[model samples]
Target: MKEIVKFSFISILFILGINIVSFSQSPNESSLGIQIEKNPEFRDVELYELKITQVFKIGNQGKDSIVLKAPTTMQIQSPQLGLKIDTIIGVSRYKVAQNQLIIYFSKDKIYDFEIFYSYFGNVANLNLIGGNLGSFYYWDANEEFWYFRSTNTKINEISISYPNNFYLLESFSNSKDIISEGTNKETFISRSIQNIPLQFILLNKLKYERKRVVKSNQYLYIYLPIDSTRNLYLNKNNIVKKIESQFDKVICFFDEVTSRNIDVIQIDYNKKGRALGNQIICDSSFFYTHHLLHEFIHVYSEIRTVKNDSGYFFLEESLTEFLAICLNYNSKNRDIYFDRKIAYYSNKSHANKSIFEVDKNSNENWDLIYGKTPFIIHLLSLRLNENEIYRILKDFYIHYSKKEVTFDDFSLFLRNQSVDKEVFSEFIRLL
Candidate 1:
């Protein structure tokens, strides 16, 4: 009996030690898992579907709950598992707002739970444009890229697979991460998808054949949109020649300040807009005239490391507008354009807010942000002389390219150049 008691006590102690080790290894840690696959059934242009799954581990030692939410515009599928807290397991409660889905769950005492949903349309992270050339998505060469991000959970790994028929065009990731098995192309990202941009391009050969490309180094390339229509504004050949010839002039204008090559995609879409980056997606009719020059200058400033802070729009948009006008205006009547803009800005009814006071929250604030402020920059240019102003812009680009800068920092930069404080101050007073 005594020997038996001693053996029993030893076994109890060993089991207790194992329990302690297990407890120590377990902590209140959470992760997010994601998988995106192309949908085959959808035939429309908006056929892509995304599956987002969020997992939360409620640490056994804690009571903090996890919240999962999505933009209200998304159509989330019903979650599979009901809420299980402690010994009690039941349905979890959630609410949907105009463009949001708010879900609450305990991550500490409840242990672990997963909530998932599917949404239609192309990935919001990718600006996808579809034409006769099929669907094209652009990735900025400069910044990091990610799909949806979680506020509280850390994304550990994301496995993304393209459509089985799609071919990989470009990928800047490690070769090991990208695997080609059978007809599908797969990439596994162990790195945090948060803000880490992927330099990649995937083409769906089943949708459209490869279009012609004019390569100007890795950064600069011109892609002609595939179109069978030789008439209307979507004329492929004429538009290509027009953009090529005009963009060549733009290259000469900012040649010294930027070596970053430009990628001009001749899209047939009827939109008259441009996104600021290494990529410029434009309608066939959009040339490298004043409109593009202005926008591209904005792009140049963006590629530079400027301190991004409030009130920097004066230096950013305004300066770009000023330069575009200066470069693209016919020498004979450039002043007419400047005077007309200044007069139009001066006549604005919403003069209650100064240019500096106009935050993004301001309603109908375009006149001040885009009009008055740029005219103010033009006014300052006149006082500082065109050469001095151009020097300031060039120097600003050289010193602060690809960096963050604020308005005060920009002001100090001008001051250091011995610009007249009174003149600069006058411009500030108007703003």
Candidate 2:
């Protein structure tokens, strides 16, 4: 009799908690107002039972889908209907009848947030995006309700009161249509870049999916269509190439491997196609190449020197921008602005600064790192001998390429080369 009573009690608590989930999804979720943040990453949302009262169609402003993010996965749900299941990175996507993901909270629970960037994929009440990951945790003891006070991602935050509601307004300039060339091989290379902000969309009518990617290599071959507006994109590509060519003489090697291995992309909505994972954005009349090669140089270089650890920001970024520029200069000799930037940081003496301090101070002088650090490499090349620096570059790539490197790991690499660490240490101090 005692065992039976205990089992019933436990079952009752589970039932009640689940009932709370359903109740929380009801219209009364927020008592003050619902404040939603527009974040693609869903990193800044604080959920505590804010229920959905209505579903507003986003119309032209929003895409026809839903977004859900978790630490290990990110999944997108099509707007076509009922609760459907999709999966990515281990997180599963589920549908909510209402356009909102309800979070229920007790009156005593603490919640706070502010507005964030609006790429939640939809603009009007027309769409919904939710998440089940990231530094996400639920605390049952706090309020006997599912409560979340934190997440892993960061963007501007938004706060909501119980009853109050705020509309999220987002705007984007008119862009071209998409041509989806679905191929996993193409996606693999695209995803490898790791810095592009891209959204993969599925077109139900045509039965296709595609994404805009970004990555930067020294050489980029862009094909433009003949339409006047399309030709504009071509012209822009030429101008961009001119700027680089004037600066560097690249030992150009053409590899059809990229386009051949990747999926076939047919032009869809926009005449100009953009690759977010790699640098390319198209407008009807023109497109721009935001090549990430220099950025990649730093990223790859950091990986070359440092194993992936906490001490990467300064050494990676600063050295990256610096070395990338050096590589650029080596390829092309033209640099007016880069020279001046290098001169500035050269005075700073590469001092020993905390990684966080450098990162935090970055908003003010980011270009300096990219420009100056590479320039330092140039100066070092002259002083240490270009052959030596080149050897370092080649060796760095050979050893650490494709593998994770650490800061201490890189420091040791330098020590082995008999490079004076203290010299560069003081160099950063000037910054």
10 residues in a row with least lDDT, candidate 1: 9-18
Which residue ranges in model 1 land beyond 4 Å of their true spot?
A: 1-46, 50-116, 120-159, 164-218, 221-224, 228-238, 241-271, 274-279, 297-312, 326-336, 343-347, 351-353, 361-363
lDDT on C-alpha atoms for all candidate structures = 0.50, 0.32
Residue-wise C-alpha lDDT for candidate 2, range 1-431, written one tens digit per residue = 00101111000000001011111221212111122222333354432222211111111213223332321111223343212222112112323333233222233323221111111221121212212111111111112112111122221111122212221111110111211233211111111222212122111112112232223323333322223234544454454454345223212212112321111122222343323222232332321212233423322231433424554654556555445455454533525645666556556644333453444335354544445445555665555765687677666655675577765665577668878777556544543
Weakest 10 consecutive residues of candidate 2 by summed lDDT: 9-18
> In angstroms, how far off is 17's CA in candidate 1?
35
Q: TM-scores, in order shown?
A: 0.59, 0.40
The positional error of residue 242 in candidate 1, measured at the CA in angstroms, is: 4.5
Model 1 per-residue lDDT tens digits across residues 1-431: 00101111100000000011111223333333323355566555333443433344344434333344443333333232112111112227555443344545454444544433333333333444443455544555444333323354444433444565554444333323444445554534444233334444444464433333332421445555343456756555565566555555455555644234455655445545564344565654556346666656665554332434566556666666667776666534566876777777677688556756555634488777767777778778788877787788777767776677778777888889888989979977877
TM-score of 1: 0.59
Per-residue lDDT, model 1, residue 251, is 56
Number of the predicted model whose lDDT against the real structure is largest: 1
Error of 2 at 264 (Å): 15
